[model samples]
Target: MNFFQNLALKYSHTMMQKALNNNLKVELLKEPQAKIAKEKSYMLYAHIPFCHTFCPYCSFHKYYYDENLAKNYFESLREELKIIKNKGFDFNAMYVGGGTTLIDEEELLKTLELCKKLFNIKEISCESDPNHIDPKKLSMFKGLIDRLSCGIQSFDDETLKKVARYHKFGSSEVLQEKISKALGILPIFSIDLIFNLPTQSKEQLLNDLRIAKKLSPQQITTYPLMKSNLTKDNIAKSLGVSFKDNEFEFYQIICEFFKDYTQNNAWSFSLEKNKLNDEYVSSHHEYLGVGSGAFSFLDGELLINAFNLNTYTTLIKEKQNANIAKAHFSQKERLKYVFLTEIFSGSIELTHFNHTLKCDLEKELFIELKALKICGAIYKEGDILRASKFGKYLFMVLMKDFYTGMDLVRAVFRDDARLKNKDFIDIMREDVDPLNAQNMEFKA
Candidate 1:
């Protein structure tokens, strides 16, 4: 059978099995109201789950490249897009993320052409390793996308080696030169920098940031070093290292520097428009993620594709004829998903919520958040809301609320009205601390 036929047969079989198990012909919940929808929608992400290599801290679903397998993957993805199109959904913003979307230039264009055909994208972006980008390939994206997010983890060669990033090298001067050439073709670019690496010093971080500032990309996102299970269980005998300077202290310094820098440059401001507004600050807001291990709050639902790429491919093949591995959300789950996405955009504007939603539970959460606002962990301007200087500075600390496990469990089992999910109960019972208040005072 051809790719489409094989895909259809697999999906049909799964639908049949589900129908039999439920003792009813399982029609998908296709009512217009039941459909996920979004307003002021911006950001679409496509996950290319084939990487040249993997980072230890990375838990993204991906595998090494294989020619025949990639063609199948593309076919499955095309089919998935058709299902969404048939449902009358479209997106405004677009982001294409790993496993490194810029693998082969020819294949990359084919994939991008498909995206243009599928989504009504206004502001499209793609992620790439520096090594993967060159003049001609970068030109392919001209007029097709507006932004480029590059993962230039470190300027320090030693740090890059320790993290296994395998990044491209040019002297800071040479690298910036090439980047400028690419920028002439692709505007609205940003760099990803990681701080607090194993045995890394604050001086090193400051130096890297100083160099990055010279390059003067519109934005620079710095994250503290974090260890996932891979690091914890790294039987490879990698050494463990703790913070040399207080991580929070380092974070505060970086935040202050960037805040002033962006303001002075007249780039753009985040959240509400302040007196110090700049185009650069205002534009860092929209993001979308897809693929196995990708998370997105598309429409009103918080959808997480399977974390296992193999499973994702299996399920997508099964989706050719009918739905495969269906999951749904509840009201509370919907709220949390909205909250998380807004939070990621660097703030939450209350004006976006319905007037009727201000009841007890929401009121309580707001009151708590407001206290943080007053103390300066977050900020509120009229109805618009955003992380305060301190909030953005110590984003890692505040991120706990979204991932307290309860939120995740709530998202996954949102469809069940009984609320008897074991995962939800377990997560809610965990001892994660509520948002800390000390961290709130003395804004960055």
Candidate 2:
């Protein structure tokens, strides 16, 4: 659809409008509350699950506003913080995400202030809708936060609508205006851009890339649209939108464009170099989770909160330990996990793999990657692994393959361990159904 045709498509009225008028005031689930540990260093994540409008591709836990409920949530959050403080925890990274973090100007400021009260935060970041940030609001955030990640997915209007984005493209201009209005109160910031939006084209993407280069956010994270049955399928159909078959090709173009902008022709993308140097990388930081559906890494375990908001609130109120469920990864699994994470960041080092892991990527993984290297996929210089000019767009998929192979290797190790235990004969005993049991014993 290129950009224009997709932009002109109207949303069909067939889709059910989500029921909006619900009194979500007061805690929906009331359980005993926990005593917060104070003065301890730990990360904090507060999820605000309300959005003015929903985007089709979004898969976050969110809901519409009930003023009273919003108020209660904030109070509950403050109480939650008190509990954390009493527990003697301190956090260096604080990220408040979703449902539009900055809806009410005054309230948002108070929330920011409250965050400061809760943690000795060094790098605090929040996600904001374009509408949430104006001159006044951006100023409020100036000293309160170290970074901002704007959900400015695309500058192409048609593509924005196809994705059900609430604001228009060039909205970054408004963001820029707000930042300018703050008069030297700019927090290091980044913008999110999605490419290969249903039926989008190379030229349209390149045009959007040029605008991104001009805006010159400290960093840019480009992602491809991931469709799911849970979101706006009708709107997607209306636009005749679909994923590109040749995704890797689209990825190469994006990588080349950005690499050139950053290196060869730095003039166009030079505006935010200083900010990039000063601010901490947003997603690259080690994070901790709070609130519903948030995941945090602690003591080599991943703790995930209940996905249901009601369940989360109930657990919080009942003071039923927030440690509801946690998954512990072994040292080998952790190494594989780190490798996967490193790949997402566009690079990894050979030295990162310690001697204990049983993965041999020297031939199957790295050699194959080099031999059949997609134009912009990866580059190897000695031990350092980095993405090439065309690799950035395809990086996510490439990383997926690495994880897939790593999983196979992990599975092999498990099989080897089981074999060493000599459980093969004993395992057959457990599965011995009358007919199969006799056959199994005969085979053995």
Query: Could you say which candidate leads in TM-score?
Result: 1
Error of 1 at 13 (Å): 44
- Runs in model 2 lying further than 4 Å from the true structure: 1-43, 164-184, 232-235, 260-286, 348-394, 398-444
The digit string of per-residue lDDT tens for model 2 on 19-88 reads 0001101111122223243333555676777777767666556667667766766665666566656666
List RMSD in Å for every model shown: 13.6, 13.5
Give per-residue CA lDDT, model 1, range 1-444, as digits (tens): 345433433443343233222221111122112234444444555777777766665544467878776666666666666655565567665667776777665676776677678878666667776766687888887888566667776787666555565343444455566666665567566666767666667788788788778777765667555543223344123425553535656765676666655431111222222221112212323333445555444443334455444555676666532222223444544454444434544665575454323433346466546545555555667776676554553334323222332233223222322223343233223311222211111100
Query: lDDT of each structure?
Result: 0.51, 0.51
lDDT of 2 at 22: 14
- Runs of candidate 1 with Cα error greater than 4 angstroms are 1-43, 166-181, 233-239, 243-245, 263-290, 296-301, 306-311, 314-333, 343-346, 355-364, 400-444
lDDT value, candidate 2, whole model: 0.51
